[model samples]
Target chain A: MTEVLRVHEPGLFTTIQDTGRLHAIASGVPPGGAMDRFAHSAANLIVGNDRSAATLECTLTGPGLLIEAPCLVAVTGADFDLRVNGAPAPAWIAISLRAGDELAFAGRRSGARAYLAVAGGVLGDRWLGSMSTNVMAARGGMHGRPLATGDVIAAGQSAMAAVTGRGLARQLRPRYDEHTLHLVAGPHISRLGADARAALFSSAFVVSPDSNRMGYRLEGPGLETSGEELLSFGLVAGALQLPSSGQPILLMADHQTAGGYPVVATVVSASMAVAAQLAPGDEVRFAETSIETALQMRAVQREALESLTS
Target chain B: MPPQRSTVKVRIHPLGDTALLAELGTRLDTAVNTRSIALASALKKRRDVRQAVAGAASVTVQFDPDQVTHVALAAAIRRLASKRPPMEEPGRLHRIPVVYDGPDLQAVASALGLSQQKVVEIHSRPIYRAFLIGFVPGWAYLGPLPDELVLPRRPDPRRQVPAGSVAIAGHQTGIYPLNSPGGWHLIGRTSVRLFLPDSDPPSLFRAGDRVKFFPIAE
Candidate 1:
């Protein structure tokens, strides 16, 4: 019989995500996906699933899941107090789940989001070649939204044998408490006055409570621009846009495809996972780095992930 | 005489390690938009480009840094700009039927010093072109409005403009595919759905498509 997982209680915000929906920006679709991609891929690896396997991205709180068939599962990201059949369970490692086994979370210990990957991966309709859900657009994933109570999701047939006792190394796990994000100068960086630019690099920005998947609104120094009217242009995730209000907003996975706000800088790809783990009231500082150094950091991160696979 | 090709200078800037922004011009003009669209089409065919999104007056190319460096990618785009790619073929034309009975209709007409009927006629007469798709999914920025119909956006934007609201701001006009808070002056509303996620391609119109709005009686 095919294994199926049923949601008893869909916690705060649980959505299915993969790598992302690539090449859909032409239609104004944001590349929505798992915010902490490193953790998402690591969870899949622990369960012996492919790197791009569809997994559950649980935000803040997690769901109560009832397994209908035997399967292997792993929970990674946002160290949550996890339990199975009301007994304490370990995180960041694959464990065998039997029929009628109930998995639940007590509370989150750290981080803002967590990833749950099951062996053989989760099955969902692929839109634009991706299963990632863009909640704002109500497109892709299961019913184009977050999972609800009583929703039954099927598990794909496993190709590789389930490898038990697999877990990520301690050092490989990302430290969610690290709040300093490395950035590279953006296209419109020169438009700002030297004083405004200095304020950006010197001040610590507190993540606002209004932030969501679209962006992280930071409350810090108000950056002043040259008051030039900027033509609307394509925007990439991680671009730090400074609107007329002077507040900087870091674009995230569900950000608009195009924007008119002047972008002062972009968070480096290597620190995107760190940005994703930040929660409300968290303080963050920015450090500017050369594009060459940013690329090198990304290479190091990719090499680290590759080592896990090997 | 054959139409002269645009010679606008294209400026390339690194967005980050993975993307590059190619600015064709600073203003919103047909020549600048045409160049952006053409360059985007050219870049889309390159293996190094993961995605090429054209905007009002710029094109952003997202590429894999591992596959191609930013410097190499920028050089290729500069070469394409200099050579000038062929203009994009026009997309399917759509005639959208709208009811000219929005709350801001009178306000827009008075602001433009034109009668309400005259505003509707001018808005419906021209076959506008889709400049770019952004701000929202399937929301096409259609433009080159008849000079007499142009007006600035409302000083205070509406808290929420209902979906299917046909609105205008500056030299452009568009239909709201989904209900959203907007600053555009609403002149009408349409029943046609501009976006259907389940449908193949999803959007009813693509960039470079022609759109004509016709007024319907309530």
Candidate 2:
């Protein structure tokens, strides 16, 4: 058994997540997987765990750690300055910790969330085949709450010690940017005024501070529909909901099971991974794409992931 | 003016990549929407269909293109449509208790020009049906609320509407099972646990479950 690491400071927002709930959409459950799914998987690759292994999803910052035993760990997604036992630890490099070593991660720079993966995955209770703590639903992961100071986290096993390769760790970095995200028009595209729909694709939007894993409320031209009242309807990931005010809010991983607002567009799933990296105060634009192109991109990403495991 | 009946017709169009486009004629009332749901369920039952979802008046069927071409699926759906029978299984009824006190409760009541108690009474009067579930886990989109309660959503949605917050937007009423940003007009709250992840049936209300609000004094 690996020793427990005591958290001295559990930064702004930290939660345990694996790949989120899958195939539960029809059950009124959104796939609340890791916001940065690709990064979450890459971190697992560093430690020889399956991509769906539960790991720490730290927000803009992370916690101060008190390591009680030596363990293999790696950090991926977002460039957060990490230090081990007060010494500089290389970013994107797998490193071993001796007994009593302390680790700390600073605020995010290039990405909104950073992943810290360890060997054998972080031990946690699984709800719906994932340790992804959907704090909103109060289910899964370290007691359905974000880690706090004095929290104890233990590595799965000493077997995580067998896979040791710094090169592999460095290769799991995620590509992130503050540019535009591509979206295809949703079912209610006609609900939006022509000018509003055009502006939606052409204009840039800033991610509001109200944003979280559930969605990103964009600050830009609000879309006004000719008709307002419609029945509440089924929605999908990346659904751009335009309320009466016309401002669009892009739904994300933990988004609701259904909604009523007019949908301006649905961002392609492949681009949503990049969208998750957006932090508050980041500028973003929207571009329109064909369903064919979006599906092709999703297919390519899925094939790449399949190759990784195969 | 006569009520618009065109809003509930279910017309399907393929968007390629297993996704289809559905256009509902215009007004979204119960009888027409019920037909939409029946159609969605039938189309979704096919093994080749990946997703069959309904919007206001239309149902989009996303299917596996490699397994079943759009033409074939459309033909199959049209065939199914011809032989479609009326809903034999009426939905189940659930009476949920709600505390009429949320951050947006007073605002919604004022906007509707009714006392909070009256608002609750009107909201609880209708036997609502689950239109669909999609925005968040365990959020039941119940609708066709009394015309009196039809009110516009908040100009600005709250950053976080706590779980079980019973809310209304225009003609629909719903309970948020998880904390989420929503524009719906808040009328009350509940603690009946709409979603229990560990439970065999995670959601309290499924699509087609009948619902009515039971107001509890705050």
Candidate 3:
């Protein structure tokens, strides 16, 4: 039988996301997708779905969902208190839900986002070969917007039989903590003064309330530059751009394709997922690392994830 | 315009682990933009390249580090930059019809010391080139506006600029494809839909396309 889910309460901001929309940046489309990619992929794996399958990326709070058909589901990332029909449900593991079973969150304990993956992924119209929703563009995923209460989503055909009791090992789960985010010097670092560069690493920055999917507006020691206006240039997801205001804004999943501000540094790929878990009011510090070290860290993490399914 | 020049210098820099940015020049020059576009087109054919995003004076190439190392990808881009191809022909010309009756029409005319009718005529005269698309989806940056029409962005941005507002700032002119807050000086409004999510290609204008504006009676 086909499976479907009805949203009872679309908590704070919930949207369907996959790996992301690639190759659309040339047209100024930001790569809007699951902020915590590591958790998104792991959740799909636990549910016997492809790692890039469409999954619900819940922000802050999670939505209350009613299962219309029996299927397997898993929730990963933030330590949200999960409950199935008022009974405690474990996260990071595949759980079976019968028809009319309700799934909801009690409260968030750690991290700022979570991923909910079903065995048969959410079947949504693909834009630029991705089911990920770009809310800024009002395109892709469930009607090209965030899930709202009473919305029904159809599930694709399950590629594997529904399985339960499959759980990720405790060591394999990501740890949520307040620590320094590693960074690599970006191209425009030379534009910054020595004192400003030192201040970037010396002081802690608080994520401002203005932060959103596009970027995290940081409030901290102002970074001083040479007062030169930069020509608009291409930007990446983790770019740490410093505008004339002197405050830094770390680009995220929905960052613009290009920006005119000077980028001082970029968060290492290995830590981008960790950066995504940061919430407003969270304190963050930066430590510099070499490009070689960043690539090695990424490879190590990829290998560890590869071992999970093997 | 003078004959096209070759031998433009391009600098390639690593942008995180997944992308490399090729800086064509420091300013908004046609030669530099052309080089950036040419390099982007050449890089798109490579299997290792995922996306090549062209900006005002640079092109960023996104790739899978697992499939191709940063060193290898940078080397490929360097080779393409050294032997830049000629600029591709501009895409089909898009004629956008506009009603010269925006709220800021009189304000813009007074600031430029020109009458509203002259302002409309000069604004619609040239066939502008779409340099890049950013700020919002489907909002094309069309430009190199005639010197007389160039004006600074308004000191205070409007809380909300209606969709289809044709505005200008500095050396650029564009239409707001969606209802967005903007600081550009609005000279007119258009009926054209710059973006349609359900339509194929969605955005009406792509980079390197030609655009023309004509006046329409309200």
Candidate 4:
């Protein structure tokens, strides 16, 4: 391992993440990782690293870093104003940097999160077989917290020479502005009012400011449920639960292991990356879909990603 | 412990493309919780599944869509759910001591129209089962509180509850493993640590575990 960069300024909520800690979920630990999985992998692939390599997941804003070694880096996910050595740089493509090169994000031009990956996967403390940070649990990735100023990042030295000139195709780059997500009916669909589907589909919902990696609380028409109060039950990312207020909360990467609210629908995995891109005040619409269609969408997404990694 | 239902109607529904939810009735029944844990345990051991987390009455099974489709995984889950789980390995039993001197203990007793000592007696009388481990790492949901002691969560939640604070709400009680915002009524505090980040498992309680709390002078 070699020191790669030092944080000059750690902007809004930057953390090191990989695909996340999947096996630890059974132990009540959340799969805390890149909110946008596709972007995370794309960033890593562009830098000629393993797709599951840990990278910096900068939320809303990004950090300023001073490069200390010859390295290849790429940024993906939310669009941001990236600069290198005080010069403008493009995102989603590999860029070569040497000692003394400065990298920084001025602000988010669009989108809510971004990924910065360097070759030889950024090193972090391994927890549950992954380096993704679990802030609440206070483990993994910069001591289970966001990167702060003065922190030095170490990266495993890759034997392959640093590669550049790789970029994701325009069509393959996910569009976050669509704001439309597909969903499938949940098990507790029966508990909802008859117009629940219509209410969910027809009404325009806005992502509440109280959103985070845990879940997005949507503000819209109150979905009425007819039965007695429900008990706590296991939930996963993408569960669209209707609370007493009728508004729905879409679970995300860091969502609780269980909740008691009635679930009306679950957003498909294909649309999760899109959901992760949304920021507070973004208009989000839901399209009802079937399981078959959901899987097909997911397959298509996976195929697009494979083209990059392979 | 609540008695098991004669029949538990389990339905496997798609939580999304990547996860499946297996529902096992709705109430806070220990039997249903046990089954949920069992199903989760079995599914977690398989290579196909990414992981499985058991809730009070459900198990959310997560998997990779590229490797297996919802239909195939659902079928496997159905087959697994149908089989009565192998003789269960009993979960670890914990005997936690709590000093019943929380700020809300007196208020709770007055609200329930009982003496402070009587309220403490009722709260400590029953053996509670760990239905799930959630709401934060190591913060367990141990419950089916004695009916007399059951009360709604406080209307206003505190911004930060002290770690190790033993609290109660609707139908359950739990000790705060970490300092966090909470709405439950605090009734006591404990010295036992529920979470150890340095430890492999971290969490002290797992689903299907038994929790018995007793009064302590400290």
Best by TM-score: 1
Q: What is the DockQ score of candidate 3, to 2 decimals?
A: 0.62
Question: Comparing 1 and 2 by TM-score, which wins?
Answer: 1
After superposition, the stretches of candidate 4 with alpha carbons farther than 4 Å from their true spots are B1-8
How would you encode candidate 4's per-residue C-alpha lDDT over A41-99 as one tens digit per residue? 88888888888899999998789999999889999999888999889999989999999
iRMS (Å) per candidate:
1.2, 3.4, 1.5, 1.5
- Where in model 2 is the C-alpha error above 4 Å? A1-4, A23-29, A90-93, A157-161, A166-174, A191-195, A299-310, B1-26, B35-87, B95-126, B133-139, B146-170, B173-198, B212-218
RMSD of 2: 5.5
Full-model lDDT, candidate 1: 0.86
Residues A234-286 of candidate 1: C-alpha lDDT, one tens digit per residue: 89989999988899999999888887899889998888888998888889999
**Model 2 lDDT tens row, A140-258:** 88888899899888777644344555433322233466467877767678877678878887888999999998899999877788765655555656778887677888888787655
Off by over 4 Å in 1: B1-7
Residues B93-118 of candidate 4: C-alpha lDDT, one tens digit per residue: 89999999999999999999999899
Best-first order by DockQ? 1, 4, 3, 2
Per-model clash counts, in order, read 0, 18, 0, 2
Question: lDDT value for candidate 3?
Answer: 0.84
Candidate 1 structure quality by residue, lDDT tens digits, B1-218: 56555466778888878888999888778767877888898899988888998888899999988889999998888778876457557667999999999899998888888899998999999998888987777889988877887777788888899999999987889999998899999999999998777765677888788999999996
TM agreement with the true structure for every prediction: 0.95, 0.79, 0.94, 0.94
For every prediction, compared with the true complex, DockQ reads: 0.72, 0.36, 0.62, 0.66
TM-score of 3: 0.94
Candidate 3: which stretches are off by over 4 Å?
B1-6
